[model samples]
Target chain A: MNELVHGALYGTLIATAILSTIAMGIWFERKFAGRMQQRLGPTIVGPAGLLQPFADIIKLLQKEDIVPRDADRGLFDLAPILAVVCSLGVAAVIPFSPSIIASDLDVGVLWVLGIGGLMVIPTFAAGWGSNNKFALLGAMRAIAQSVSYGVPLVLAVLVPVVLSGSLSISGIVAWQAQHHWFAVWPIVPGLPAFVIFFLAMLAESNRIPFDIPEAESELVAGITTEYTGAKFTLFYMAEYVHTLVGSALGAALFFGGWDGPFAPGLHWMVLKTLTLFVLIYWVRWSLLRFRADQLMRLCWTWLTPIGVALLLVSAAWVTFGGTN
Target chain B: MQSAWLSAFAFLLVSTLVGAGLLGAASVLRVRAKYDSPLKHNTYECGEEPAGMSWMQFHARYYVVALFFVLFDVEAAFFFPWATVLREEGTSAFIAAVTFAAVLMLGWLYAVRKEALEWQ
Candidate 1:
């Protein structure tokens, strides 16, 4: 009974945290992007625009919900919900601290990768259901990018799992707790996996530098061209939530989740996750978007081979001379 | 010990079945009549009528890419379990794993040479 309650409570807490943090992320992303473009973004919506996300949600909810006249009604209505649900689902297995995981299953890593990757289905559904030329183009490009980049993303994630020797994420965190931090190791050494992971993280979250699917300038808002009101808000929320998930996962894998000294375990986990979140925002603001072909080439030619090589080197390191 | 593990697995299976059944029933019984509309039946546009068909056959490259993806993806899964045990297993096990990886690499290379990856 206690275990079940613990699971339910942590599940709800984590869900609330993810939703709220993502809402904040949207406000910050817009403000930062506007600053980069030399425009003031939503400053009137309460102190430094902190309440902008809330205001935007209220405005959207008040707007008249319009469905497309010729759209595939079922899928059109379903896509945004699917996107939000899939993104939120990925949060279930993530370990916030030693005692704070929602579900500590044996195949936790696989479960995350599997369900998380399904976000593309909803994205495609939006494109197909909207019945617009630009939406189709954007969705097509997105499908290409997601399928291509996702390979390296999974492989890069697997490197840490390889080092840790378990599919369970908490098990990996426990391994990191013992091994002087896996980041310090020399096998597939330095920060190649980390850098690759970061790039893949950006792609996965549909952030700038790899957000060609939703390229505003050329594709006219890309796959989300027709979305409006509360549905659009749901899509926006899902986008931010996915970003939080990617950042947290990256932190857990590379930055030693819940492992800092002088702080409580949960505090360390939150600090690391938030730090990565800020870094993600920094990269999004600091970089320009990549052309579609350039993005594809980077994934296949650079990231994938490096990920595969890291796996081999990591295997060799474990086989001979052992490891920390 | 084995019975304890088996019982735990059984419990998980039962719960999973119950959860799936409940979700299935709830979805079927929902009030669909109240929400049905002409706008809902049509393709999605901001407020106007939609233009044309949303589905178009994409380039053949995506299929090719997907095939290669499945090939390499399955191969990577085998390495995870081996990574955990390698530290204690020593050289003979290392050589066997290496040989296995080498064969897979050869298959990948052959696919590459055969223009399986020529996306252009």
Candidate 2:
């Protein structure tokens, strides 16, 4: 009974934190983008636009909803909901602190990757259900992009698992705490793997440079072409949540999550994650989007081979050099 | 540990409900302006009349890429368990894993030679 209550409490708390952060993240991204573009963003909403996301939410809620006459109503409605669910579901395994994880699954890394992979499904559903050519094109591009990058992403993740000799996120963090961050240690493999993982993370989350699915200039908002009002907001929320969660996962795997000097615990994790988040934003604003062929070639030709080689090298390091 | 998964599932359920509830509320709260026009219902095709159905056959590249991805994905799945035990398994295990990766790489190479990855 005690365990059940504690579990429920933590579950709710984490959900609240994620939801709130997502709201704020939207504001932060907008404000950050505004600064980059040399303009004020959302100044009218609340105190330097801190309340902008909330206002946007309210406005979205009040906007008239629309569904295309030819759309598959059932799947169209379910896709955004499923996207949000899958995006939020990944938070369950993430450990903010040593004692603060919602679920300490032995295969936490695998679990995250699996849940991350599920995002593609809803994206496809949205595209296919809309019955729009652009949406279908976007969905097809998204699947190809995600699946190609996913190979390297999974392989890169394996580098840490091989080094730590455990699939658990916390265990990997503990290993890094005991030894050194896989990102910095074993320079030959760790750095490359981390780079591949970071790039794959960006691609997987459909951020700029890899956001071919939603290339506004081309696809007319891609998979979301048919959605309106609150439904569109749901898809928007799902994308941001996925980006944030992917950043957190990246922090946990390669950046020695929640382990830092001067201070320790969840603060470090939050700082690391936010720092990565900021970096993602910076990258988003800075880089040009990759063409579909260029994106695929980068993944299959360069990142995949590097990822596979890094995995083998890490395995060899574990077999010979030996770490805790 | 088992309880943790339950907690995770519970969180998923709660979050889904919250999301659905929010959408439901939005539907009720939002103004309903029913402008009935065939033009409003047409798919946006850059101000031009949308020719034919959007569900026509697409390029075969997507299917080809998917096949390649599945092959690599299975190889990745096999590597996870091999990774977990690599530290203890030592050199022999390294050889086996390398062989597995090498064979997969050969397949990738073949795909490359065959232009399966070519975007054109």
Candidate 3:
């Protein structure tokens, strides 16, 4: 009974944290991007626009909901719900700190992958249901990207699992805590595997440079082309939420979750997660989106093959006893 | 395990409520002229009148991509269990794993040779 209550409390706390962080993430990204582009961002909302996300949400909620007459109404409505749900699902397994996990599943790493894979479904549904050429086109691009990039993402994540011989995320972190972190412990595989993971993570989450699925200058908002008002807000919220969770998951897996100098705690996990979150936006504002062909080529020919090779190298490292 | 997932279930249920409730609230709270407008409901077509159904046949390429994804994704599942026991199973496990992946690599090679991954 106590365990159940602990899980529920932490689960709710984590959910609230994710939603609020997304609010600040919106403000932070805008401010960060604005500074990079030589302008002030959201200065009017509330003291440097700290409350901008709330303001945006309020404005969107008051706007008239519009579902196009041509759209498949049922699927259109279903997509946004699925989007937010899938993004929030991974939270259940993430160990923010040693004691801050919701479900410490034995196969926690696989849970992340399983939940992450469902993100593609919502994108496809939105595109098809919108009944717009651009929407469908965007969906197709997204599906292709998901398929290609998913391989490398899985293999890269697998590197840590292989070395530690544990599928549970908490297990991996325990292993890393003993060895510092997979990010540096076995640098031969850890460092390269982290690279592949980051690249694949960007693509999987539809972050910039890999955001062709929603490219405004080209696909005219892509899969989000037909959405408006509150539905659009939900989709936007979902994306940010996924990125934040992705940051947290990556930090836990490779950066020593809750393991840092000056004592171990949730603050360290938050710090590393925030650092990666900022890095995502930095990369977004700094680089141009990749050509679709270039993105595919990078994934299949480069990242995937290298990801598998690194997995082998990690195995060799473990087998030959060269690990820390 | 039961208790842990129970919390996860509670979390998911609450999130669903949050998602659905927000959507419901927005529809009720949103502004309208208390009138129906046809123009407001038309699909976006780059400022032009919308045409036929947008859901149509797409490239056969997406199918091939799905094929490849399934091949590797399933192979990936095998690795998790194999990894956890690699320490106990030793080099025999290593060789078996590599050979399994290498055989799958042949299909990957064929896909590349066929240019199945081309985005166009």
Model 3 agreement with the true structure over A163-225: per-residue lDDT tens digits: 888998888888888876989878888989888888888998899999999999999999888
What tens-digit string does per-residue lDDT give for candidate 1 at A124-237? 898888877778888878877887777888778777777777787878888888774566665353267878888887898789999999998887777778776666767777
Per-model TM-score on C-alpha atoms: 0.85, 0.96, 0.96
Docking class of 1: incorrect
Candidate 2 docking quality: incorrect, acceptable, medium or high: medium
lDDT of each: 0.72, 0.85, 0.87
Task: Supply the global lDDT for candidate 2.
Answer: 0.85
Better of 2 and 3 by TM-score: 3
Where model 3 places Cα greater than 4 Å from the true spot, the runs are A1-6, A322-324, B1-3
DockQ of candidate 3 (2 decimals)? 0.70
Kindly list the per-residue Cα lDDT of model 3 for residues B1-120, writing each as its tens digit: 456667666667656766898899898878976988999788898999877767688778788878788888999999989999998888999999889888988888888899987767
Worst 10 residues of 3 chain A by lDDT: A2-11
Q: For residues A123-209, what per-residue lDDT tens digits would candidate 2 score against the true structure?
A: 999999988889989998889898888889999999999899898899999888888998888887888898899899899889999
| Error in Å for residue A41 of model 1 | 3.6
Q: Clashing residue pairs, candidate 3?
A: none
Off by over 4 Å in 2: A1-8, B34-38
